[model samples]
Target: MKREGRGEQSAGPSRTEGLEEAVRQADPDRALCAGFLPASVRADVTALLAFHTELTRALAPARSAAIAGPMAGLIRLQWWRDVLEGVRTPDHALAPAILSALARGVFHRETLLRVLRAREAELNPEPEVSPWRQMMRDGAGGVQRAVGEALGVRDEAVLTRLEASGAAYGAGAMLRHWPHIQQSGRYLFPGETAALRQEGEAFLQSCDADTLPPAGRLAALPAVLAARDLARTSAQAGQPRGLGDRLAVMRAGWKAARMFQKSGEPAL
Candidate 1:
C-alpha cells in the first residue's frame, strides 16, 4: 500500500497514452478494432485491457515456475485487489492508466472484481471444462461489459451479446495457445480441445456482426476475429497468423468504424 498518486496524477495523461500504445502492439487485433472508437472511449478500453494484461503477467512467473512460487503470484493478485478496493495506490507501470479510468467512472469495480476472482482460480486449475468455461466467461466477458459501459452503452441485451462474444474469444485464444499453456503445466480437461473448438464455432455461427450497434461492433472486434481465425481451413492450436489475416482484421475494423460514424445511436 502506497500513497504515490500525486506524481501519477501530474503525469497521468501522457503515461496513459503510452500504456495504450503498448497494449495496442501487444493485442493488435483488438487494438485495430478499437481504433475505430472515439478517442475517449478507446482510451478507456485500453486502460481496461491494460488491467487484464497485468493480471496475466502477475501469474506468469508462477505458472512457469520461472520466478518465486505460487505464493508470489498470489501476493501480486492481492495487490491488485487492494488497489481496486482503494486500500492503496498500485505500484506498477499501468497504475496511472487504470487509476485514470477509475477517476472517469469508465471502469466497473464489480466486473473487475469478478475478473480478479477468475484469475485467482487459475493458479490451481481444475481439470474440468465446466469450471474453465465459467472462468472464461467471468474473466473475458466481464472485460467486455466494462468496455461496453465505457462506450456509453447501457443496454443489457447488447452487454449480454458482448459477454458471449468475449467468452468465445477467450476460448479460442486458449485453444490457440494450447501448447504454451500445456508447457506451463496448467491443467486442461481431457478432450477439452475439441470441446473448446466446438463451442467457439457455435458462437461464430450465432454471431451476426451486422446486428451489433456501432459501438457494440467495436467491442466485438476481438471475438469476430477469433471466430474467423478458428474457422480457417486446417486451423489448429499454435498456428501463426499470416499477413493476410492481419489485412482482413484491418478491413473489418475500418468498416465497423465507418458504420459507427454513419450511425451515431440507434434504438435497438
Candidate 2:
C-alpha cells in the first residue's frame, strides 16, 4: 500500500536514530499498531511498514529518477531480498530494523523468498492482470501465512481462510489504484487500467450513499471495506474465528478511512 523513498541512508547509529525518530513522527494509523501487537512483533511490523513506506516514497516521481520504472522495481526487490536473508549491513536506514525484526521473529526464509519471487515477476516490462493477480495472491498468502504462524495459529484451515480473505482485500486494493499507477507506466493489474479509467474520478468522488451505484461502487468503496466485509461474513458464518479479532481488524480499517476522509484525503 506504500512505495519507496529517496537515497539510501548510511546504516549507522545515526541512521537508526533517524529511523526511530521518523517512526515516532509517523501518523497515528502508522504508529498505533504497537499497541495491537506484542512488543517484539509490533517492532517487526513497524519496521516492515517503515521500510515499505520508504520504498514507496523512493518510487514516487519527485524523488530520485535513477530508480524509476523497472530499475526501481529491481531495487525494491533486492531490498526485500536482503531483509529476508537477514543481511542488515546495507546502507539503507530501513534494512537494519527489518533484519532485526526478522531475526527476532524467526520469520520463515521461504516466505520471504516467495514474496521476492512475486516481485521479480512484476518486474516484467508489461504484465497482464491475471498473472499479476496470481503473483499478488501468492505473495500476500505467503505474508499472511507467516504472520499467522508467528501468532501461533496452527490449523491449516484457519490459516488458509485468513490468507484467502487477506488476499482478496489486497487484490481489490491494487485494483482500485490501477488508474493512478497506470498514468506512471506501472500497471498493478492488466485490466485494472481500463476499468479505473472507465470508472473515473467523478465516480470515485460520488461515494456517498445517495449517489452510490446500484451495482456497487467499486471505485467508491475503499479496499479495506472489502477486507472488513470478508471478516464480518466469516464471523457470521460461525467459523472457528474470534469475534474480537475480526472486529479489531474491521474497526481499525474504518477508523483509518474516517481519519483520512476528515483530512480531505482520498480514503482508498
lDDT of each: 0.70, 0.44
Give the TM-score (vs. native) of candidate 1: 0.84
Model 1 is weakest, by summed lDDT over 10 consecutive residues, at 1-10
Cα deviation in Å at residue 240, candidate 2? 33
Clashes of each: 0, 12
lDDT of 1 at 84: 82
- Give model 2's TM-score versus the native structure: 0.54
TM-score of each: 0.84, 0.54
- Span of 10 residues, lowest total lDDT, candidate 2: 212-221
User: Per-residue lDDT for 125-150 in model 2, tens only?
Assistant: 24454565456545554454454444
Off by over 4 Å in 2: 1-35, 54-69, 79-83, 86-88, 125-130, 154-156, 192-224, 227-268
**Highest lDDT scorer:** 1
